[model samples]
Target: MPSIAPDGKPESPGKVEVQPVAKDNEIRKRIADILITTSWFGEPRVAVQEGIVFLKGTTENDEFKQWAGDLAKNTEGVVAVVNQIEVAPATIWDFDPTFQELNDLARGFVRLLPMIVVALIVITISWILARLTVYLLRRGLLARSLSHLLREVMARTGGMLVMLAGLYLVLRIAGLTQLALTVVGGTGLIGLVLGIAFREITENFLASLFLSLQQPFREGDLVEVAGVTGYVQRLTSRTTVLMTLDGNQVQVPNSTVFKSTIRNFTSNPNRRDDFIVGIGYDDSIPFAQEVALKVLAEHPAVLSEPEPLVLVESLGPSTVNLRVYFWLDGGQHSWLKVKSSVIRLVKRAFQDSGISLPDEAREVTFPHGVPVRMIEDEGAVESATAKPTAEPETVATKAEASLQSEAEEIKEQARRSWTPGENLLTLSSSTDDS
Candidate 1:
């Protein structure tokens, strides 16, 4: 209807033709053609009326129905989309059913229910049995006080793996291949990660196993490996910990322990210790050797199986050297104590025998000159009265001038080459951090 003018004259309404688009039907038809012909599924039942598309079809899923509707809606002049695609049931509905067929169907359902119940029963029973077995085994192993780390990993992983196997059996019985595949995929991914990320960790684990089997050293054993000599305190999966000589707890990688040379001082109950004893050149070499051997033979700890050797090894400038070898039982034998005991005994023996043990060599030489033997006692004698005539100075004065120069030089050298954290920074702490 046309709007009324201000003069009160009614205008005619504009044309409201609403002429239908002729091409709209053709576009919808084109879309229907595309869907039925181009798709993987053979054809779809389609209909259109008054520029509205009604999708009516049998399809595998809602996806195909919506797809058919969308295709038609995208056409030039489609006004609305109506989807009426019904999903086909997987089981065929045979209308003409025989009595035997009906009975068989009932039988199938009944058998399926019983089998499912049986499966649940078997799973529960097997699971209980497995748990009981694992618990028994774990308790027995734990009672023996096995390596803590190994025991923990073994117990946990053993029970878990057994449980996983049982679960897989249950899944298989229920015909859940998809679920089983998911589990397999996850396990494969975990194995891959372990293989790639924990390369060193795996090596360390194997090395730890090797260490346990080898019996090269054990707890409280004094061992030397890779220049870090210490007593074994504990062994973990990745590393062997040691109480170092300086009292620092040192954790060395099992990989390193395996790769390096391992000297186990405590493996054997008896350890042979040897040190060269120096006597004055004038002292009888034969008498000195006997006295040294006698000193070792008198010690209770000395092993009598292998007689200790006390023979002249070398002739020093001021003394006659004799190699004194002795064997002692026990890992706790102190090196300092053994040497001190032998030294004190040797000194007493020599004194009783009227033999003089040579003191340290006192060579008289200037800084730049060749070492010279002093005929006079003035320069060589260690006495207050006798001193170097070049200048009269106290011992402290001479020591300050000479030793201070050495101390400063040592400090300078230390400062120039001393980088304490160089190797420490180079070592990895990522595993420990983790």
Candidate 2:
């Protein structure tokens, strides 16, 4: 006769009832078998009765306990899984009571006590060191003579950098980081996120740091940046304040200042001026040059350090171009004012000497095959009417002509609009759009 298998399906009847019993010994051996076969989960203490497996063991956590119970329940003849897992708490030696524990604790305290004392001593010493370091760096900057703002920035930043690094290592030696990591996700993650989000702020701060370190220009120094010419008024951690030539205040990012090429007009005390003096072709080049040199040298604001230069720089189509170069004391005189004064002086000097000055110039030569125009006479030109002539047509006739012209123009425009590219647009656009 046929019988049912352990899974309740049909099996040979001969295998019926010298039925196996599962107990502690048999279950343990089977569990070991399960472990050997799985190779990932360790052996778990198991007791099986009528194919129901009861699991008992100490494990790291629920996941490990579940894995062990699952392994036992999946073995042959197993019907169900019952887990009674005992979780082991993290082992810390602090609260153990024994002679060995006491001895170990004593030894540990002895070993660590001196380090604690040393740390305290070092901290006091480092505070002194930081103050001394601050003093020395500040004194050095003062001796070399940096701005008060710049010196203060360097002292604070440099001192803090040194002090903070020393402080972190001391906290580490005291096991601060290890203790913090055990609770929740850890302070490391908090620090990492903070670092990422504040990266730009860090860069700007460093830019300010560079500003302090380099001392590129002081307050009231003229600088041109991003097409704005201004005098630097204040420098801060995030931005630099500039007062523009138009008397407007502008704030520039410190990072942009660090990244860009800055032109400091006031860096050098003396500045060079250049301009072209135009005189008619009939005027003498040497005469104009001499007059320009006189004008530049006679200007009180011009510096005596660099000698003035005046020369016939170019021969133009209708004019002689004389270039004048001289050193000016600074923006003590405005650029436009100085330029205007020089041009006026030269113009007056030339008028007094009977020298002619022309406005615009271009070369015109008799090139064959080029068209030319000649006006009849100055009197004829004066008598000519500049406006277009009006035809005396009636209003109805004019309106009709205008209507016909508009119709023709509309048709012509429509024809011209159907270009090759326009055809592509016509094809791609929706029918409704058309």
Candidate 3:
């Protein structure tokens, strides 16, 4: 039967056609010709038998060997392919590829010369703009009252923003818009990571900023903050330094200072001090109060406006406890020295007036029995029973004589220790109550 074509035409019954199958030798020859044309393979051998092709060769890389196998497998009449090509070990270093790469890079650089020039110009202009911005900020009237640290921070931040904007523009001009975006995104990510990693440091930094702006306390001011009572020596970026009454230096973290309650004793010139004084139960409370008030009134350091107070606070086991409260000019007089003087004078007054201040009464018990001893001499007994005469007036100590504030000494010490610029506080701003 004759087969009909797709066009519906009848084929001739006598016409017969046969296509010859490609022999294994022909397939081998074709692959050999292809491998010879390329310089990738060396000493490549090709074999074919029974319509199956075999390939073996040495090439500089596996990619070239695979190329040879693919050529053989694609040849006509090839039933299967066995590729056993080995990658040759490189003996001598090839500098041609390296030279070619360098040459390519050089050409690329030449092509980007105009963009590089533009970027350099942009960087220069950005630098100038940043400097100008900082200069203007420093000289601006709005920033005149700001603390030195705050002003510097603001100026530097503005300059940095300008520089960043310039960088983004330069990247866009260089046809690296994606890189620019990455830089912008990466900056935020990096900042977040750094903030997390250095949490305490960041907290302290922010606290210092607030402290500077708030000006809660000033250098040389007596302050009790973060469980430390001392004269504020200086406020720095990381810590607030203090000189204690004991002449010891203490550095409290700014974060702690900001969070803790700050008691600025120097903020108010008039500061009150109190001490407990106990008198005998039999002693007249009114007489004792009058005597103590007289002593406080006589003291030069005590403020007369807020009349010194002597109130019956609590009754002790053997005595009447009185709380003596007095106000003094803290800025002019040392509260410690003034209080000491007042106490000494009060004690003298009480003693002179015969108002007895006694110790706590305690009953001693004898577990076994009470022992008794009799005096042999009558003179000794008489002398023991006799009351001693009143002693001469004692001279007041230096603390009582001089009630000057100790902050001056602390301030001098702090000044000697650090430069004025290092301190974030200004003496002029110290008086600001707000």
Candidate 4:
């Protein structure tokens, strides 16, 4: 019908003819062509009416049906797609040819049986060689000086590497080179991940190895490390064990023990002992010094090689502070016991020599009107210069002598106590002996 002209008369439509539009059938044919050419699409029936594509037919699977429908939906001039394609169910015919295929596969494997047997033989030989390599490295290559635990670990690691190499060769002989490469690549990736996760463990392990080589402190040695003082009980790959003086066990990480400052008391048998004595400022300094020096020199535990020293270190408000220094054989006796004895002996000498170890004194000033009361004890008061009832030697000598006897007994017990495990050098000697 021509459009109505604005003038009441039917306007003559311009001599124009509408070209015929392409029909849905042509679009359907193009969509079918596209579906047929797609590899994933099986036989899917296609129909089109009014530019809407309808898919219907049986395919091998749902994937083919989906792919055919998608191609139809994207076809030019397609309005919509209705997918009703069904997937075919397997029938006895599907298994008809599998028997022949299996037979062929068996024949092929039979033909390759000799190669398989040879590969297995190679693998078995490789395994045997790996074990032999481990034995040789453990008994010959590794130094006896190495810790036994470390030596074993290194030997096993070398064996594992050899075994892996053998496995790679077997895989290659079996025409499985791609599989071997895949395994190797995967192993490298897994190792990277584990190394990152166990970084601290690896650090402590390496630190322990270095410490073993350094031998800073041996088992049974008394050491101070990372603010802990104790006798070293054992050393392992990860930690150093210490038995404290109170008999409690402490486990320190090897990294901390290696990095921190360590004080090995038993490294040297001799150590210096120090004590401060306050004497009256009015007393003769020279006399006080001479008496303290003589007491230290006479003590049996004190070392005579390094002469005992007495120095006036500082002056307090009331008395003079004299610092007494003496060298004692730490291994022979307890340092604390000897120092206690020296203090007692010096105090008695001061009293006998009439040199006062004075207390700090201060004059308390009060307001002008304040009254002060003096309190006195009911007990008898002994004068500072009173003569001794017993001999000065008897009073000063008794306490130290008793302590020394007890300390000697303790020292004997400690000496008799033996610990387990061997240091690196000891292990080396034992290996040689065996």
Leading candidate by lDDT: 3
Model 1 residue 221 lDDT score: 59
Better of 2 and 4 by lDDT: 4
| Global CA lDDT computed for model 4 | 0.74
Q: Residue 352 CA error for candidate 1 (Å)?
A: 6.0
What ordering of candidates by lDDT runs from best to worst? 3, 4, 1, 2
Candidate 4 Cα deviation (angstroms), residue 389? 6.1
Clashes per model (N, Cα, C within 3 A)? 3, 0, 0, 0
Model 4 spans with C-alpha error above 4 angstroms: 1-115, 141-143, 171-192, 199-204, 361-434
Per-candidate RMSD, Å: 19.0, 22.9, 9.2, 13.1
> What C-alpha lDDT, on a 0 to 100 scale, does residue 379 get in candidate 1?
54
In model 2, which runs have C-alpha deviations exceeding 4 angstroms? Answer: 1-196, 360-434
* lDDT tens digits by residue: candidate 1, 226-274: 7887766656667777666665567788899999999887667567778
lDDT of 2 at 142: 62
lDDT of each: 0.64, 0.63, 0.81, 0.74
The whole-model C-alpha lDDT of candidate 1 against the native structure comes to: 0.64
Model 3 lDDT per residue over 1-434, tens place: 22445764333233111236687777777677767776557788899999788888788866566666666666767778899889996667878878989999999999999999999999999999999999888778253566778888998888888988999999999889999999988889999999999999999989988998888987778899989998887888889999888878889999999999999998888999999999999999999999999888877788888988999999988889999999999899888888877787788789999999887555577999998989989999999889997543433475366778877887788667753326788633643534
Best TM-score goes to which candidate? 3
Which lDDT value does model 3 have at 407? Answer: 76
lDDT of 4 by residue, 1-434 (tens): 32334652333323222125546777766666655654334475678888788987676666556656666665657778899878776575677469879999999999999988988888888889889988998997565577766777788888888888878887888889999898778778987898789998987888877887777876667789999987776677788877766656778888999999999988897889899999988999999999998888787778887888999999998889999999977766677777887888888888878998777554566768788665464433345445667535532255445433233343344445553434343464355457
Question: Taking the tens digit of each residue's C-alpha lDDT, what string does model 2 give over 274-383?
Answer: 88877888777777778777766776655667898887788777778888887765545555455556565666777767888876635456658688677788876765
Alpha carbon RMSD to native, model 1: 19.0
